[model samples]
Structure formats: C-alpha cells, structure tokens
Target: MSVNLNNKKESWYMFKIGLVIAFSAVLAACSGGNGTKNGEALLTYGNEAPTLTQNPKQLDLLIFGGTAGVGLETVKLALARGHKVTSVSRRPERMTLEHDNLNNVKGDFVKSESYASFIEDKDAIISAIGVDASSEKITIYSEGMKNVLKAIGSNSSTQVVTITGIGAGDSKGHGGFFYDRIVNPFLLKEDYADKTRQEAILRSSQSRWTIVRPGFLTDEISETRYRVLLDMDGVQSGDISRADVSHFLLAVVEQGAYINETVFLSN
Candidate 1:
C-alpha cells in the first residue's frame, strides 16, 4: 500500500484545518472569571472616566460593554475621528455623546435578540468588554463574540475590532521564562483562557477582524507613540494607556493593518 504525494499534502492541510476548528471550539468555551456573580455592575471605567473628544461622523458604531474606561475611550477616539457610535449594554444609561456622531442601544451579550438591532447595518464595532470583575455571570467572551460576529455577518458592511488581553493565546511573554511560567500563569490564567476562546471566535469568523491584545492596561497616557506586534510576534510591556489602545483600534481601521491577525500593543 502506498500514499500519493498529492494525497499526503491534502491530508496535511485537512489536519491543520481540523486543528484550527477544534481550537476554535475550545476558545468559545473559555469565558469564566472570579468576579461578583450578581450585581447591577461597576461601570466599565472605575475612576478613569472617558472624556469625550469631538465627534467623528454620524455613522453608526456599535461598541460592546464599556461606558467608561477603555470602551468609552474607544468611542471617544472614534468620534474624534468622525465616526458615529453606539454602545450596546443591558442597562441603558443617560450618557450623551459629546459629539454629534453618537447613539446608544440597550442590550446584553447573552441575548442574541438584543444584539440584532444594535448590529444591523452598522459601520464598525469596537468591543472593550473586559472579563475582569463581571466575568462569572456572563457567557464566555468568545461565545458572546460569536454572537456579535454572526450578527455582523448577516448585516451590512461592519468591520470589527475586539480587544483581548495579552497572554490570550501564545502572546504571553516576550519577557521569557519567568514571565511566562510565573507571572502569566499566576495572574492571567482565567482571563487568558477566555481571551483565547474569544480570539478563536473572531479568527474563525468571516468578518474583517482585528484582535487587539494589549499589555497591562493602565489609565496613564503617554507622550511617546506605542508599538504594535502581530502574527505570533512577542512583545513585552509594563503598561499601555487605555487612551492609546483606543487610538490604536481606530488607526488600524484606517490602515487596514493587523486584519485577521492578533496584534499585541505595548508601551
């Protein structure tokens, strides 16, 4: 018995595709955390409230979760760049978009029905939802993300930029062994699990996706420009401001860099 060369190549490719699909399933199941299981919720931004800049345009931009912190900042940057925005959440707030290009939608990640109107015919989506304190009650980030991707896929042109933390998959340490084994394993295990799952959802989707994996997020803005590392490249960082991360999201949409790639942004 003998195998043809072309058959062998076909088998190898099929094996790789199967591996990717299996990984995607694992990623979709990783969203669980140790936060308060039930509560009204802490605002996405604790104290580092996002201040609105000018409006971008009046185009509909549906963002997931954050009303302050990074999510809010992401909206602000998008508005500043002239893109209209809306944020999907379970509890609708009275917050006003400082720019003319902003709107709001009340929705939840667990309910696909709620996300439909929010995503229909939108321009782009920038998700800043974090699995930090609110992780336990919600579905896995990737699961929620799959819902988002499906919604976008059914609708009009809608690009997506979803945020996941560093150490999400293999992006853990440009810092080497001590960081990978000790620091990441101890501090980021659960979040990374969810993140990896979320990454899988986005990567598998047909939507134009950019997974922004930033190093430790902080409230501090920098005078110097930050760096972007994509394609399994390693990047280490002490911190990156939520502001910078938001800006990076907007910039990528314009440059079309990092599309269908996992990019790590660091200080």
Candidate 2:
C-alpha cells in the first residue's frame, strides 16, 4: 500500500495534538486545576503539600497584621499572584502597593471589632504578627492572636497561619548556642514567652490552624536551598529570607496544607 505524503503528515500532526491535550489534562489535575473544594475553593490533592503550584485557586485572604515584616511580603506576592488580598494594619496607607485585587483596610489586630468585619468573608487568615525582642514585657503576640481567634469564631473553614519565631514552642533550644543562651535569654525572653502563649491560643481555638516558625529572619535575599522541616528533631535556627517565608506562607494557605501541625522553615 502506498501512503500519500500530505495525508501521512496530517495524521502525525493529529496524533501529536492528541498527546498534547492528554498531557495537559493530567498536568492540570496534578497542578491543582482551576477549581474549588472544601467549601472555601482550596486546592486539595492529598494531605501532603505540593511545592510548586502552577494554577492556584484565587483566594479571598485577610492578612491580619499585613503591614508587618512577613505579612507585608505576603501581601505583595499575593497581589502579584492575582489573589484577592485584604491587607490590614493600623496604617494601611503605609502599604503603597496598589492592585485591582488588593484591598487595603484599616484594622488593629488587638481589637476584634477593628478587624472582625473583614474576616467573615475570607478563605484564610495569615496572622504575620511579630513584636520586637526587648527587655520590656511583651504580650502583643498572645493578645492579638486572642482577638484574631475571637474575630474568627466558629469559622473553622478559615485556615489560619500564624507566624512565630524559632525560639517559641518545642523549637526553644534550637536558635543556636549564642542565640539561645545570649540573644534569646537577654532580648527575646519576653517575646518568645508571648509567642508560646499565642501558639497555645491557636492550638485550642476553633479555627483550623498551622503554626509556622521561621528561623533567624534576614532582609538578605535567599540564595540557598530552602528547607521545610515539619519535624524539628535536631533542627536549629538558620538564616532564611523574609521573601522565602512569604512564598512558603502563600503555599500553605493556597494548598490547605499543614493544618493542626507546627512547621519550621529555613534556608
């Protein structure tokens, strides 16, 4: 049988197109297709989190203390990713990044009424609350988180990601010898104490919570390989960029990963 050259080329082209479509369908499913789940439009494949998500579901996110270090970084990245982000702070005007999906709202996390109005409609709330390490007694981490939990009463669907430092919780003695003995004791003693209280609040709260403990945060860009340790066995504080932490936070909320668990991040 003699094959027609033009007809043969057409058949091959059609076969290639079919393969492309099949590959794309599987990729879409694995990459979290443009869909919703679990009443809040989350991407759910399995309990384990995917590191790289290509097509993330657009989320309604309320960032309590969104003007803070990690919170501010998350707001910028979330807006860039086209998610509807409500960046809350006492001075929201300080966040000059404007986007169609961005909503700058005046809110003080210390008061429930100040930010409760905004939490009702959010899919997740990232409490990037932090306080300076000082000799003075610190209670903002605990107090503010208490107000946050109150605002999100009975809303377990609203995934809450709270940022605490490495010296908090079981990661206490992991901030390096000098840092754990000197810096943490003399400087961050009060701050870490409050952060411990804050973690307790979230763990006992009604909201689905994931507590994130980032190691020794720095303004320097992260050029090293990122490390995420769900089990902090023998882990110590390492330098990680705020930028990388923001990326990790966004992933947690979007993928609905790490509920009821404490995660450690470093780079």
Candidate 3:
C-alpha cells in the first residue's frame, strides 16, 4: 500500500510538470512574434494576424473627393468614429452624410484657392481624388495633387494620405497579366501615366505622406482583414472593397504607421 501511494504521487507530479510545459510553449508561441503567432509573418494574405491598433481620439480630417467611392466611405467612417470631417468636393449637396461634426465644402481640385480655408488647422488630409476611366485627358490626377501640395505647403506635421491604383507607382507587374499587359497599357494608359506623376508630386513634397495603392476596388462589404504590401514583389492581385480601404486609411491615420512610405492593399 505504501509503494502504491508513492507511485501515484509521482505520476501526478509528472502530469503537472507536463501540463506546465505545454502551457508555457503555447504562451511563447503567442507572445513572441510581431503581432503574429507561431513565427508567422504579419500582413501576409490568408494568414491569421493581429490587427492594427485603433485610434479613439477625435481628430479633424479634411478629405478631397468626398462625394464618391473611397472618399465617401472615409467620411462616413470618420464621422462614425466621432471625428470632425470637412469634405471638399465640386458638389457639396451630393454628400449625404448628416452629422453635427461633418462639414461639406464646395471646391475643385484644380483650384486650391477655392477650398484653402478648409485646409487650415486640419489634423490630417486624405486625397482620394482621381479621374474616371472614360477620361481621355488624364492631367487631373497630377494637377489636382499639385494643387493639394501647394495648399499644404511646408506643413510637414499634418499627415497626408493619397489613394492611387496599383499600377500607379513601382507596382506595375504585381497586378497580374490582364492588368499589367493589356488593361494598363490600353484601357488605363493615360490615367496610369498621370497617377505616376501624382505619386512623384507627393514624393517630392515635404509633408508626411502615405501613398496607398489598392488593387481592383470593389463595392463588396468590408472584411476588415486585408494585407498591406510595402513593395510590389510577391504581391498577388486581388480585389478589395472600398470600405476596407477606408478602414485601412483610418488605421494609418490613427496608428501613424507607414508614414512617408508607399503601401499596396489587397484582400
């Protein structure tokens, strides 16, 4: 009876030690990576990764092209987060967002003086300005960006985020063959050319800026779990919703990551 009791005590002790070791291993796996588990790289598509931190404070945001697409979504999201948003667009009445802190200003991208008053004392500026695919003369992208740069001259403290397509910058080949070879050259040739010029203007500007290149925007609901690739290499072409893009932009503003960096977004 004494020997059996001693054996049982030893077995219980070994089981407890094994359980502690297993729990410690799990903890180490979860805690060591950069917002990732089990040595996985964060921001890789299809990988379970931690999300970017959310910002809770109210901020003053000035957004251009706020009537449509990503711009409209950004305005809605910003207002929902209790931030003061000034939307600059050619048609102010088109912006249907009704909020106490939302202000819609009628302005043209080509003429910065028209909305220069709205840019003052803004915490951040988001430029979602772009020309349509049917546009033949694509000078609006660069010219509008130039106007924005001039409007915010020497204001390096204010964060600036610009939305451009995937083929805008050095991400020419990452959009797959249909986009890289045919669509980019034939369908969006003029538009992409001006977008490249737009990127150049932002790069040379002194303001702290982040250039977001989204792949094939769609109107689907936001998953809120998207990938941000800093470079074009190994990036797969996929469609991401405008809502997701807006979420990422707000995250960038709140988290202050990727400042002075160009990143590509995809689902």
Candidate 4:
C-alpha cells in the first residue's frame, strides 16, 4: 500500500485546527467567557467590561436612522427599558414602533439639525447609519456624522456612540481570515472608506464618544454573550446578531461606559 505523507500531515493539521476551535468554544462557555483575548475584560473604565451603573439612569436617547436595522432594534430596546427614545427617520410614517416614551422625527441622516435639534437635551446621541453603494462613492456616514458633529457642537453634554463595522480604522484587517482576504478588499472597500472617514470625524471631535465595530451582522436573537474586543491581536471576526449590537449600544449609554474607546463585538 502506498501512503501519501503530505496528505496525512495536511489532514492532521486541519483536524487539529477544528479541535482547537471546538475546545475554545467549550472553554469559553465553561469559563463564562472573558471579554478580551487573554481573559481580561475590554471596555474597562473603573470597572471590568461595561456594566450597568449601580443606579442606572433612565436615558434620553436620540437615535439617527432609527427606522431600520440596528437603529430600529436600539429604538425598540430603549422604549422597552423605559427610556425616552427619539427616532430620526427619513420617513417617520414608516416607523411602526410606538410608545408614550417614543418620539418619531422625520428627517434625512445627512441633515442632523432638521431632526436632532433635541440633541441638547439627550443623555446620549446614537448614530447608527450605513450605506449601500456600488457605483457612486458613499458619503452618508461621513456626511451624516459631519452634520451630527456640527449640531452637537462643543457644549452639548450628550455622549455619542456610533456604530461602524468590521472594516474600519485599526479594525481594517481584523475581520478574520476570509473577510480580510476577500470580502473587505473586494466588496466593501468603498463603504469602509467612508466609514473610516466617519471614524475620523468622531475622533477629531470634542464630544464624549465610543465607536462600536460589530462583526458580520446576523438576524439572530441576542445572547448577550458576545465577546468585546478592544485589541485586534488574536481577535477573529465572528457572527454577532444585530440585536446584540443594539444591546451594546444601549449599555454604553445607560451604564455610561466604553467612552472614548473603539470596541469590536463578536460571538
């Protein structure tokens, strides 16, 4: 019988990788998971991970693009938590979620003043905007962020938390192996360029801020068990549900945590 040594070695290596991934998942579950790469929590500011304040404040949240996606999830979550929620949408009539605490404002995201003037009174302003561009360069994120920064100015006490995605800033190459090698370079370069510009606008601004970078978004239910990574080292892009993304967005403001930092959320 003829044995192929290279094939045997390749098979063993592949199997080892599979076992390591499985073991990591089991270990993470058994350990209740650490928020960081080496078993330390990320998003620390006088505490481990972002936590609810000992006495949580009923937040006044103004959300841009709140009619859809993560923005909609955030709006729904905020209302459920008894917070005063203002949803800025291009078409307010399209917003189906309603509560006594919910206010629907009609306006384009690129024109912040037209809708978010109530920003001055809010505890936090959450910008959850994105674009789908194939031909024209996308500017909705940067442009909207510019208008938001202008409206926010230098005096408003509103803490800002903006959600960008996996391919922005220092997070440019950390969306696991396949995404970094294929999806990002081939598909999302233009979108991510604008997202990078959006990040720049927030970093250069004077407002209190936290930028969340969630991995490939799914429609799955929120487990609230995702990993929060502040460092790209040893971090792999994983699936995180949009519901979980909203949860982190709310936590950042309600708990008054993850300020001035960029975090990557994955499961």
TM-score of 1: 0.69
Give the lowest summed-lDDT range of ten residues in model 4. Answer: 40-49
- Residue ranges of candidate 2 with Cα displaced over 4 Å: 1-50, 222-224
Write one digit per residue (lDDT tens) for candidate 2, span 1-267.
Answer: 887987776676556555545754664355421212222222222133236478788999998768768888899888877799988888887786878988899977788787777788678889886654455578888899887777777755889888997788898987655557656665568889999999998898877899988876768663435566676565655667888788888888888888888987765
Candidate 4 per-residue lDDT over residues 130-238, each given as its tens digit: 6653323788889988888788778777898899987899888766555576556555677898899999989998889899998778798887777677777755566
Regions of candidate 4 where Cα sits further than 4 Å from its true position: 1-55
Clashes of 4: 0
Each candidate's clash count = 9, 0, 0, 0
Our tally of clashes for model 3 stands at 0
In the range 187-248, model 1's lDDT, one tens digit per residue, is 44666777788888777777888888776566876432555654443234435688888877
Higher-ranked by TM-score: 1 or 3: 3
lDDT of 4 at 98: 69
C-alpha TM-scores of all predictions: 0.69, 0.78, 0.79, 0.78
The deviation in Å at residue 185 for candidate 4 is 2.5
Q: Report each candidate's C-alpha RMSD, comma-separated, in the order given.
A: 14.7, 21.7, 21.1, 10.3
**Pairs with steric clashes in candidate 1:** 27-197, 31-140, 55-79, 56-79, 56-82, 56-83, 57-82, 57-83, 89-107
Estimate the overall C-alpha local distance difference test score of candidate 2: 0.75
